[model samples]
Target: MARYLLKRLALMVPTLLGILLLSFAVIQFVPGGPVEQLVYQLKGRGSGGEAAGGGSSGALYQGNKGLDPERLAQIRKDYGFDQPAPQRFWLMLKRYARFDLGESYYHHQSVTSLIVSKLPVSISLGVWTFLLTYLVAVPLGVAKAVRHGSRFDAVSTLILMLGYAIPGFVLGVVLLVLFGGGSFWQLFPLRGLTSDGWAQLSMLGKVTDYLWHLVLPVTAMVAGSFATVTVLTKNSMLEEIRKQYVLTARAKGLSETRIRYRHIFRNALIPLLTGFPEAFIGAFFTGSLLIETLFSLDGLGLLSYESVIRRDYPVVLGALFLFSIIGLVTKLLSDLCYALADPRLRFEGAPA
Candidate 1:
């Protein structure tokens, strides 16, 4: 097992390098640079002289002429934006060797520091959503499977299907309208991490306040993922119920509940475990993009969206790389989990 894990870990380096190269190439070839994005933002803010008509185009050109040309060149040189694509690629590769992810042009902050600061919020949201998804989904799925063809099963199936069909953003909007639209019906807060005066609370009060703010965003994020887990669990349990071991266990005078829970449910969960990593990682990053945006949560997804619009290559690349690494590692962990859960997967000379 250790050897298998080490081998998988070793393969990640090349895979990550390939991803970096492809990402870098795409970013480099995309229209507009960081400077263009800066200029566009400045113009939008009514700061650009040309946009504001504070100076004629020729005067602006002459003003640029008076600017220190060497300093301008040095800025480009320092960023490697002046270098050719091939040269810049090599420079980036060299920097990667030193674990330097570069700096954000817009924020003027180290990419690492920026991501680190934002990561906790995303992780906090993801963790809560994941917990809620599994806690609700697994039991609901088991109930549906056990009571198959009953009214309970039918209603649950219908609800799960509807949840799956609806987009997360639409769901978020519906939730917002229902809970946050009116003063009388307002059960949930609309935005931000906490209500005003939260900081003045006692420690327990602070914790309660934090949880109160988390409820809406976490609910919005969990809905789609919960549906997915429910469906998968229901299907897996249904299949496990039909298997011969379940019947044999019942025939051996096992209690109905024991046969279902101990024999069937345990085996049924193996397939779900195979998807656990994908579900967790997807929930952590991809699942909450729309929900986060709708709720105005400052998460990695929100940051990445803003970075892309601003053409912040360093921020975009850094976030993408971090997400990719997480996904790869999760996949690796899932494989190990499969081996641990199923004896068939543990054979030393097993076929690849």
Candidate 2:
């Protein structure tokens, strides 16, 4: 296990380098970058302020002309755009090596600071969604597997299918329209992680208010996610129930429940357990964009989206690098989870 971990960690270096290189190369060719955005903003202000203050056609045209060459050059230089792309890439790598994520071009805040500020919201949303997803999915899946072909199973399968069919964002919108401050009912807050004056609430009040605000967002996140795990669990258990060991246990006069729970469930868990790491990590990062936007939650997902639209390169690349590292680590953890779930299983180099 130690050797395997060391080998995987060593391989991550080149993998990360390749990912960074590809991303940086793409960013280099992308239009409407920081320099262009700055120039556009300047020209827009010139056109708006001057024309609104009664400037003539020639003046408006001149305002539209854009920045002087020296000013443009300076802007480019300040953004390090004047350097050759390769040099800039190398410099960026060096900075990252030293753990310096640098400052945001537009916000003027360090990329690390921006991520730190936003981490809580993402963590809150993610943790709740993760806990709720597995907590509900695993039991529900076990029940479905045990009662397959029954009325309860058929009905639940229908409900799960419907939920799986509807996208989380769409469900969020529907939920908001139904339960939010919309005309239907105002059972939930419109948008936010907490109500105003949340700090003033008592301990129980704070917990209530937090869960109150959490319901819609977490519900939305968990909506479609249930199907994958639930179905996998159901199918895995069903497969296990039909295997030779289950038949032998049943022939030995074991109670149906014992055979199902002790034998089938334990064996089925290997497939289910292996997915926990990825799902847990993913719950924190992936599939959060629209839900955050709908709920007005300022999470990492929203930050990444805004950075991309605004061409905030530092934040984008910094987040990309961090997320890539997380992804690689998650993959390793997943492998570990697999081995932990089934002791009989062995990797290529693992001791027999």
Query: Candidate 1, after superposition: displacement of residue 64 in Å?
Result: 8.8
| Each candidate: RMSD | 4.4, 4.7
> Number of clashing residue pairs in every model?
0, 0
If candidate 2 were superposed on the true structure by all CA atoms, what would the RMSD be? 4.7
The lDDT for every candidate, in the order shown, is 0.75, 0.85
Candidates in order, TM-scores: namely: 0.87, 0.92
Colliding residue pairs in candidate 1 = none
Residue lDDT tens for model 1, 289-344: 67777877787888887787666778887777777888899998788778766777
**lDDT, candidate 2, 1-352, per-residue tens:** 7778899999999999999999999987665566666665677653222233332333424444745888877887999989999999999999999889889987899999999999888989989988988889889999999899999999999999999999999999999999996769999997888889999999999999989999999898888889888999899989998889987998899999888788888889998778788888887777488999999999999999878877789999999998999999999999999988788767765565
